[model samples]
Target: MALKKDLKQKMISEIDGNKNYISVEIELQYQPDLIHLLREEINYIGQRFYYKSKDYKLEMCGIGYLLEARYSHLEHDEIYEYWQNIKEQLNTMVFHEDKHHLKFFGGFQFSEHSLTNEWKDFGMSHFVLPKFMITKENGRCYLTYTDHSHKFDIDNIEEILNIVESKAQARTVSEPKMVANKDIQSEEWKALVTKVVALMNESVALQKVVLARRRKIEFQDNVDVEDALQRSLDSNEASYLLLFESGKSQFISQTPEQLCQIENGKLYTNAIAGTIARTEDESENNILKDELLNDSKNQFEHRYVVDSIIHDIQSFTKQLEYDKKPTILTNKHLYHLYTKIQADLLSENVLEIVNQLHPTPALGGFPKVEAIKFIEHEEFGTRGFYGSPLGYIDLENNGEFIVSIRSMLVKGKTATLYSGCGIVKDSNAISEFEETDLKFKPMLKALGVM
Candidate 1:
């Protein structure tokens, strides 16, 4: 605390001495699992805020936040509506970067599995510099964010501090309180679970039937979107949405697994399903991996995911590649079989494939349509962006979409964390409940859920 306080004081002093400039560079050395927590889901857009840091990460390109939506769910469509609206929104709306509004990318989508090693091509990536970048450089995961307020002077720090102090100095708002009741004891959810269990018993081939629960939190403060996000993210909670856009463009996320990424023309993807937390030691981790792989119920649950992604990409590209076997990625919290798949993306832009690939079995279910239907009416209220793609593909469409897992929706100090596990026919609700406990690690740690 002293170090951070001193650092902030020094930074402010420097700015004050400068008299008029806002060239501030802030860095946070995030922990490893914490970095992965950020990686768990990708929020492509937000109202308007900037944050960056590099702490702990696995292996991949380092990415970071660009700019907030200034308000979540900006009528950004105006930027593309007729292409002329771009100028209108620019004139009226506040964007992260004033000059460049969007980016786009072109790549092929494959389902048959091809390009397992070439991840840079299809692996998710972002332009970290010139703003923020989240990716792997060296071995550690690092995120670098740059803030250049056009409103501030570049030569004088005081000039910049004046604006930031005035704009960003809002008092930390209070946490929103939620009301829970005994309604859950005999709630429809209890009945829904029973019906789902019955369905699992009747179906011989069905692998997992993951179910979810929802509760509402009323928004209280007239808080800025960035404040809402910071409260949740700084806490290590599992959720991806934060009340933004003055309560309009709510930040929603749906990530738990890497579906696919395409760059240049290569496709990169991972197969993530089946899980168990670490009991400790390397051997303990290995045991969990083995159990997940051999378990019929687990395997069946994972296959649905593998099949969904494989087929989703097929609609866009023909050439593909995949590792004959799935590799287990052991995190402190859980284990997942991740197979690297790649392919030569066709001439279509990246969005062509992304549009069809979201909500794979890892999130929805085997059959996308059926799963979505079940989730919508069965999972309580709207999943909103909870299971949806929550990252940037850029205006150039050259960005990665992370499965918004291990995340939560933060409206204020109080936030809601969410976790889900694929429930196969043999899946026990109690055990699956435990699985969610493990999946909750990333966000839970972030949100102080523990």
Candidate 2:
């Protein structure tokens, strides 16, 4: 690992106009232990910094967290302009799926994200907003610094904010909202879901399967990306976040579950299965929570996810400790059975553990291969970034993943969102449909769709 000064120098050199283009990476060691140093750095960066990255040059498997930078315009494409400003600095980009292959219920003209909604939709906080992030996607990636040059004793993140502010124009609106036209009752969806269900039942799938839907919404006339991001931040459905690429805006999230979280050396994963929305009264809410917990079907539904995670994490950890009893967690709108699982990872690094553990019973079905095949071969629509984990992992490697239960991608005024659920023998189409509707609330409110 290089000293902090050396790493800062490397960053400056890479940014300088005079250097020959060569990819460079430097691991800066920490003096105050990895966690404290990282926490201090992230806390600082959270206040400032405009950031961007392509995608991971490093191998990614089950990412504990991922951070994605997105660009969205009002009515036209302007990525080239943004790219021109930082092309030389970027190292990778997130893969863009061809529109022809993707299904559209409400599919729109633009959607760009690094799958963090998969983590956020499930209620896991988006990646830690690392003081520094190694971000990638769309054939581009970069190691962005949140803080540099400890030489100058900066007391606040204002300088970083200034750097971010300088790169982009002020947002055009007070809030960004989603505009989509979707017909869930359409025959097209029926056929697609029917085919997917058959494939899932026949394959080595996880016990549950989540299917998502999306539609595109365009701004009526004038709206900026910043407006959308700010609206997302202020949405009641869920919290909002601004990833890398501080310029153009993309809004993601409203998830209600946590997939995996690593703090210090302890790992916590949640079994978020089953769903029931809250009502007007406390008595009704309590009843709903108890009903969700006591409901045989809901319990049965949740077990599939819990079991799958236990199996996956066990692949790397010798001693997996879990809260023996699952608990009912009530949120603003719904109630869910959330079981917390913890273990000390056996791998030398946390990234490996994430790879082996992702697509748990919650995301994918019981047998991952079959469930994936079912979705790939049978479903007419593509999931896009809806069901994928999106969050950030700092140099210390501690991070979290939300279920991606309620999230969307944005490009310009157009956007697309996705939602899915576990379909067991008992999962009725109508019930599952309702479940997905509840799931959409997070981003729905963010986009003003609801």
Candidate 3:
């Protein structure tokens, strides 16, 4: 074991007094229980973030904040510009090896809208470089400590070492008891969908629009953010798992939709819109999948997504390709029509791609502007970070952004789950309602409320 005094002296020696910022990473031969550590520290730290890739190839746990850029009531492009300016100020260094890069984690709101009390902690756009992060990649783990100044505090280093070496038993988080579950805007959402369908049928230019609803679940005791995250991870292995906690609010998601993933100059995304509930029986599941694929309404919904993605990315992308026919992506309770999209990027400007490709037809609607207008005018509540682009971006501009769907917002003893369905000319009000209901089951089960 490396002595705490030796490590601290080494880190102090590496600090350059002239530089305004520094990042120090130490690779650990044995992996630490990051989730357990996060649970132990988040309360005192006040802000935390976590992410797990769909393939389980990458996982990160971030604590506190070394630097952060957050904005409210800013348009997508404006937020991008601000974030770029902030990135210009960062100067980082890594020890042992230069294999890993520092990353900023957070997300944008669904749109420029009023912030509900539940979502105020998360602004219109927010990203942070954590003071300390445990990154796990390909079975190896590394602990990174970052700060704004080159000066090192010996006491701080000693504290970090003690916490890392502690053999404390894992804290217990009993399953919380549910006191109440209420669906928000049930009748109003149905009415809004009916109106949107009528408008889509009336106008040739207006093809589709998606409407979302919220469900509030209250617990008898304050919910354990880490426990809920673990249950969600246990149940959802094929989706992107995310957590962003600030102050009293925590936003969590197990979303299957990839907004965009940029790696080695290659871009990857997905077109997921059409959906159907999965059944217990194998034959019945096959029938449901077939029904979803062959159904003209679902096909139209899926086609709109595919066409819109190609249209959005064509100007800045080349060699773009996707399946001509949609396939089934099965989740714990549902199946969605899925198409994988890949392209060669003309520029590695990730936020630019995010600005252009966000609110895909799957989450918003076809004819992006018109669909968003309909949602803004008709939707019952503000979306906050739900249905938004949420993920991490590294210094090299290579990272993944997943659509924040099948997600929830937690404050104290209450958790508010959000779900939505695309509405087109053929969409039935009752059917769309049922689809959203099926979408809520994953978070519900993860919370042990079902």
Candidate 4:
């Protein structure tokens, strides 16, 4: 409490005379599990964000909305332009860059146009610069706050400190309960996949389109976001685990696909298609890996992804390179044919490239527009944020986004899990159905349903 008081005094003094810039980071000794704290305590206050990769983690509790830009209807190019405008505004607002601090956190929906009422709150694209944040990186932790206005009140500062102290002291671990699980529209999803594949086989413009399904699970008690996140951390160490809470809806995922990452003037992305189930036996796993690499159907699906991504990014890249042959990337439940692609970025604006590469052949289909239209007409339900890019971008335009696959949206007792598979001419409806089931295993096991 004394340290927090001192920190508050420092901030007050900094902002007392000057109104343009006030940002501070106070080093803390104790490191708390941020997701646990968010779920257990801070969520009641305002919007909360939790992001974790292998080496870095950030948890943000919005003290107040510093700046927010949302659009319900906009073209992709227009959305990118609006975001650039927002970034320009953020650049002028002074914030302390204490190593791993996040200036903003939010995501874009899968589609530019709204599809259903379920994702109305999320809108088509939204990002928020929170007033308070805590970041843990490289075994160190810091508490940070930023305010660019003259209305910096001491009362709000004290409230934030109090909440932090309370959450730090009240840490308790609890187990998540396993409850009933129901697959929504099982037959309809399979039928849709069959229809799309049949069209592809008949020389339709769509060569490969990914189809998704939802599974609804009910828990005996209120679902704990922290508990599910812990399961994700335990099961998938190589994946990016994130949680974003807006009002009653909590979007969370442990995903392995990198939609795009721009850092130090280079662009990085991956082609993660062609999935195969993992086996407990090493020899069996090796055999499955070989089969996936050699299987014509899986290779064809993967080829479309590589080709589409290369074409999409060609305009913005000066020099591009990617692995000629994909390597096997294994998770707890499945393995994927993964190819790494790198390029020299022509512009500092990363969102432009992200807008183009999104819904790649891996997620949408071969011909981007046609595949999306087909999915829109054929799929049973709206894809809220599933298969979309979700991550943060800073004032310097350095950021990373992960494809929101193997994820779920939890509201109270009910949670909806999303999983999808790429469909091509040779794709079997039953096989695609089984592939989706395998894809669901990660989240299902995390939720204690398997």
Candidate 5:
């Protein structure tokens, strides 16, 4: 209570004293579960974002709209330029750093021109400078607020603080419930995969294309986003659990693939492909792992990802390095072939590098432009933010992005789950269909459907 009062008084004093945008952060001694707090305190349908990494977590509520960028109906090449314009605006804004500072949280759609009206709230690309944010790192928690108007309302600040304190003290754990689930266009999706593989085998300029399917689940009562996120965090501790809410829809995922990360003048990312299921028996698990490593079809699928990433990033990187052999990354439900790539960055613009490397062979396909064309024309449903990049960029040019996979979009009682698998010349339609099913297990179990 004393800390809240002190923070309120300090915010009021700062706003009264400054003419420019005011940003303040106060460290809290006690740690609170971020998603639990969000579920209890956030009243608005949209204007919420949650991110959890292995070492750090951030939860943001409310939107001050200090700076926002949205673009629709833009070509692939033009999108990067639009982002540069937004970055220019962000560069001019004055920020006060206190070891911990606020960053823009958002992501781009899978395709700018292909985005449907259903995802109007997300736009082609969107990012927000949240009004209030809670960040936890290194065993400490901090609360931050940004006042773009330069006039703080002490009463509202007090209310927010009170809610935080109450939620921190009286946390309740919710139980998961089973839901009714249906696979949307199951047979059609399998047929599409078969066609794609046949085309690839016929040498139709498509070597490898990834196909996705959606599962719609309905619950008797309104689904709790926090509970769903908690389940993901508990199941996949090594992966990134993220949420982005816009209007009434929330996009959430627990992804193991990192799109890109730049730190200390170096760039790092991974090639994560070639999926196999994990078994309860150690011997069976080892057999599956070895099969994934030695399987020619899986290796061919994975090499495209590594080669495409390396080719795309070579322009901006001085020295690139990666392991010769990919090791197996095992989660609770599955195993993936993983290879780490590192390089010294030659360009300070990290977003530019991100643009070039996004939709790698793992997500899109080989011969990038042609594969995208086929996906746009052949895919049965909209990709929305699935298999796209989502993360934050700081003032220091250091950021991390994860490919949004093993994800779902929730609206009220209904949730739409998304999963995809890589298709190659030897890929069988039935096998690919089964692979997508395996991919769906993470989100399915998280939603209490499995």
Candidate 6:
């Protein structure tokens, strides 16, 4: 109570009429089950964003948007220009030493091309600063409130607290049952993979081109976001648990691939490709891991990823280092060839780094531009955000982004799951199809539809 009074008084004295926004934060001693709060489904808030790190160290849930930037078909430079304006407008009240809750969370579509009507709400690129957010990090919880005004309103602050305090009783909702499932263009996708492989064999420039497919599912009833998210969290703790909800659509995923993590001019990323499915037996899993490491095809696919990432970022990086051989990274249903890469950045321009490094050989293919062109022309439908860089960027330009694989887009009773695999000259269409099947299991299981 005293803290609230002090904050109100402080805002009154320090409010600058010229500024466009104000953000204030207070630490919460009481740790509420954030997932439970989400289960409450506060509809009036309109939109919500959720992110939990792969390591289980950071969890955040945000409600509504105090400010947001949404754009379609904008070039990378233009997107950064809007971000610069956002950075200027963001006014964070220095409440304490821990100033970590202020962040812009969202993502860009995989391509700038025209997408299907299902992706209408997501746009080409969208990011938001939540109106109210709860963050749990290193055993501490903080509630942050941001308003689209220079002057703070005590009534608004009080109301935000009241809304959070009025927690709903936990309910036991059964997972929605699956009614029908459709694999969109299964035979066509396999044929496309074979065609891409033939193109790779003919042209040395395009050694590898990643191919993707979509699966549309129908449920008996409307799926509960909380239920699906909770199941994903329980099952895929080793992967990034992420959700971006806007209006009637929600993009949710538990992805194991980390595209980039920038902090204090240091860049951390992983070259994650070369997939193999996991088995129930530990010895079988080990055998599969060894096979993945030595298999010429998988190794070739993984190398393209490592080489392309280094090629793209070498100019912007110093002392960049990664292993010559990739180790195994295991998730719920699959194992991936993983190579950790780190570098000291010549510049801390996050957007430029994202621009240069995204659509790497892992997702797009080797020889970046050519592979992307092939995907644009050949891919069945547009990839709105699947396989794109999806994560948050903080006010200081230090944040993490994970590749959006093992994901699904949910709208009412229908959900569309997405998965992809790298296609090389030696790749077999049937084998690649199986790999994507493994990838789809994570989201399928999450939705209780597998």
Q: What is the C-alpha lDDT of each candidate?
A: 0.45, 0.47, 0.82, 0.75, 0.76, 0.83
Q: C-alpha displacement of 317 in model 2, angstroms? A: 1.2
**Model 6 error, position 272 (Å):** 0.5
Candidate 6 regions exceeding 4 Å error are 1-18, 44-46, 166-168
Please provide, for model 4 over 95-152, each residue's C-alpha lDDT reduced to its tens digit, 9 standing for 90 to 100. 2344535456677788754458666667677776666777776676766666665754
The lDDT-based order of candidates, best leading, equals 6, 3, 5, 4, 2, 1
Model 3 ranges with Cα > 4 A deviation: 1-9, 43-45, 75-89, 154-158, 165-173
What would the TM-score be for candidate 2 when compared with the true structure? 0.61
Question: 1-450, model 6: which lDDT tens digit per residue?
Answer: 235677678767876656787787877777767777676647633489899999978899988787668887745666667777877876677555787577788878898867679998886878887887888888888878788774467576666566566666757757677888999999999999988888878879888888889999998888777888888877755899899987788999888888899999999998998888888999999899999999999888888889989998999999988998899988777788999999999977777888788988889997888999899988998788899988888878888888998899989999999999989898899988988988898888888765
Worst 10-residue lDDT window for candidate 1 reads: 104-113
Residues 139-215, candidate 3, lDDT per residue (tens digit)?
88787777766444435544655676667585665667898999998998898888888887888788988899999
Listed per model in order, the count of residue pairs whose N, CA or C atoms clash below 3 Å is 90, 70, 0, 0, 0, 0
Q: How close is candidate 5 to the true structure, as a TM-score?
A: 0.90
Q: Is candidate 3 or candidate 4 better by TM-score?
A: 3
Worst 10 residues of 2 by lDDT: 99-108
Tens digits of per-residue lDDT, candidate 5, 1-450, equal: 544565555555545333444555677677766766687755645778888774445444433345555666433344444445544543122112346556667777787537665576786777766677777766666677666454544465445566667754454545555467799999999899888877887896989988888998888877788778877876745778888888778898988878998888999998998988888999999999999999998898888899999999998898899998899987777889999999999986666777888899899998899888988888988998999888877656677788999899888888888999989888888988888888888787677666
TM of each candidate vs. truth: 0.60, 0.61, 0.94, 0.89, 0.90, 0.94
lDDT: worst 10-residue window of model 6: 37-46
Task: Flag the better candidate by TM-score, 3 or 5.
Answer: 3
What tens digits encode model 2's per-residue C-alpha lDDT throughout 205-257?
44555555555555554334334444544554332232212223344555655
